[model samples]
Target: MDAHPGTEIVIDRDAGPAGKLAMSIRADRAFALGDFRIDGKLAGLHGQAWRLDATTDETTLSSSDLPAIRQLSRADATRQR
Candidate 1:
C-alpha cells in the first residue's frame, strides 16, 4: 500500500507482497490503511502475525507489542513514537 506523503512506509522485501505491505508502526496503524483489500490475507491484530481468515474480524496492535512482532517479522522499527 502506498503510504501518505511524508509517511514512513516500511517495505520488507523478505516478506514478499505481504512483507511489502507489512510495517513496523503501531500507533494509529489503522488510519494508514484507508479501506484497502489485502488479497490472499485478511489483516489481523498484532501477535497473531500470519493468520487472517473468515473468523477474523478486526485487529489492532500497539507499541508494547512491537518487540515480538519485530522478532517474528524483520523490519526497521522506525515508526515507533
Candidate 2:
C-alpha cells in the first residue's frame, strides 16, 4: 500500500464462503460505507474500487506453477521468467 494510502479494507465473513475481501483504493474525494451522496463525478466511483473474493477452490496458480506457489505462498512463477 505504499503507492496508495488511506485504502480501506473490509472482510465480511458472513457474506460468503471464505468471506469477501473488499478493498477501496484511495480517492481524491471518496467515502467508504457512506450513507448517501449526490455528486456529478464521484472519485473513481467514490470509494468502491476493487474486490478480491477467494472461493474454496479458486486459485491463480496453474498446475505447473503450483510448486513455486507452494514455496512462496503468493508467487506467480509465470511472471518471474
Candidate 3:
C-alpha cells in the first residue's frame, strides 16, 4: 500500500498468525501517519517512532484482527472546529 509519495507498505501473508497479517513500512522520512481500517475496525498508526536509520530500518506491525480484513479504506477524520 502506497500511503504517500515516500511511504509504502509491504505485507507478508505468511509471517504472522494463522490468519493474521504482518507488514513493513518503507519510508524515506523519519516519521509517518498510517490511517486505515481492518474489517471495518479502527487500525491506525500515529505518533510513533519511525526511524529509517535504525538497524531494522523498516517498521513492522502485526495484528490478529488483520486476518479478517477483506478491504482497506480511508476516512477523513477532520471535523469542524
Rank by lDDT (best first): 3, 1, 2
Clashing pairs in 2: none
Which candidate ranks first by TM-score, i.e. highest? 3
Q: lDDT (0-100) at residue 72 of candidate 1?
A: 32
In order of TM-score, best first, we have 3, 1, 2
In candidate 1, stretches whose alpha carbon ends up further than 4 angstroms from where it belongs are 11-23, 26-41, 47-81
Report the poorest 10 consecutive residues by lDDT, candidate 1.
33-42
Candidate closer to the true structure by TM-score (higher is better), 1 or 3:
3
TM-score of 3: 0.37
- Candidate 3, residue 50: the lDDT equals 23
Off by over 4 Å in 2: 16-75
- Candidate with the greatest lDDT versus the true structure: 3
Note the residue pairs that clash in candidate 3: none
Residue-level lDDT of model 2, residues 1-81, one tens digit each, is 122343333323334354443222223334342221123111212212333233433311122222221333223334346
Candidate 3, residue 35: how far the Cα is off, in Å = 7.3
**Clashes in each model (backbone N, CA, C under 3 Å)?**
0, 0, 0
lDDT on C-alpha atoms for all candidate structures: 0.36, 0.28, 0.44
